[model samples]
Target: MKRNPRDIIVRPIITEKTVAMQQDDNKVTFEVAKGTNKIEIRQAIEEIFNVKVSKINVVTVLPKKKRVGRYEGKTKGYRKAIVKLAEGSTIDLL
Candidate 1:
């Protein structure tokens, strides 16, 4: 089935750890939609970056509790994908 561009990817999560890992020359990570699968992620990366993907690993993140003054709530859950590209392939999303 053809995947919607909107459903392809959500956004790049620029976190301190992610940035540190990037500087250390490790894997590149991204926050993807919860319903997106491994194959869909691979296709999305390939289509968006025009680069070859070697391997793709996905993980689900649980919600965290939030407290603001007297208000309390839970954050939304999400899915993350760690995309491993070919040795020479690179994506300049930064």
Candidate 2:
């Protein structure tokens, strides 16, 4: 199924590790839609960020159980994508 760029790419993942990867390896991470595939993710990142993507890695995070005072539930599962930009190209994710 065709997916909109905005819908495919949920949000950029900004954390200590992700920031370090961006600086050292030219890689950026994003939270993507659960049903989107690698090719769709690559296309969405390229189109939305206007950057040339050289490689893409996808991972599925399973939901984890959590407990409150008197209740227990599971967090939502989500998909993550790591995109590597072409040499000499950069995405200003600020």
Candidate 3:
């Protein structure tokens, strides 16, 4: 089934680590749909950014437990993809 690129790529994740990766490793990070795979992610990113994808690394992040006084909660879990763009290709996300 062909899915919308917007649906496949939930949103871009901006963080210090991700920013460092983007600058030094030519990689960008995004929160992708849980059910999506590497091929779908690659296609979505390529289509949305119009850039060549060199490699993809997916990481399943588990929810983190948190507490405030007597209240306890867990942060939502999501999947993140570290996409490495091909040489000479770049996405200006900032």
Q: On residues 1-83, what C-alpha lDDT tens digit does candidate 1 reach at each position? A: 78875576898878888777656664678889878889889988888878888988898999999999999999999999888
Model 2: lowest-lDDT 10 consecutive positions: 85-94
Spell out the clash pairs found in candidate 3: none
Clashes per candidate (backbone, < 3 Å): 0, 0, 0
**lDDT value for candidate 3?**
0.96
lDDT for each residue of candidate 2 in 13-91, tens digit (9 for 90 to 100)? 9999999999999999999998888889888888887888999999999999999998999999888999999998898
Which of the predicted structures, 1 or 3, would earn the higher lDDT when compared with the native? 3
- Give me the runs in candidate 1 sitting further than 4 Å from their true place: none
Residue lDDT tens for model 3, 43-79:
9999999999999999999999999999999999999
Question: What are the runs in model 3 whose C-alpha is more than 4 Å off?
Answer: none
Q: What is the C-alpha lDDT of each candidate?
A: 0.82, 0.90, 0.96
- Which of 1 and 3 is the better model by TM-score? 3
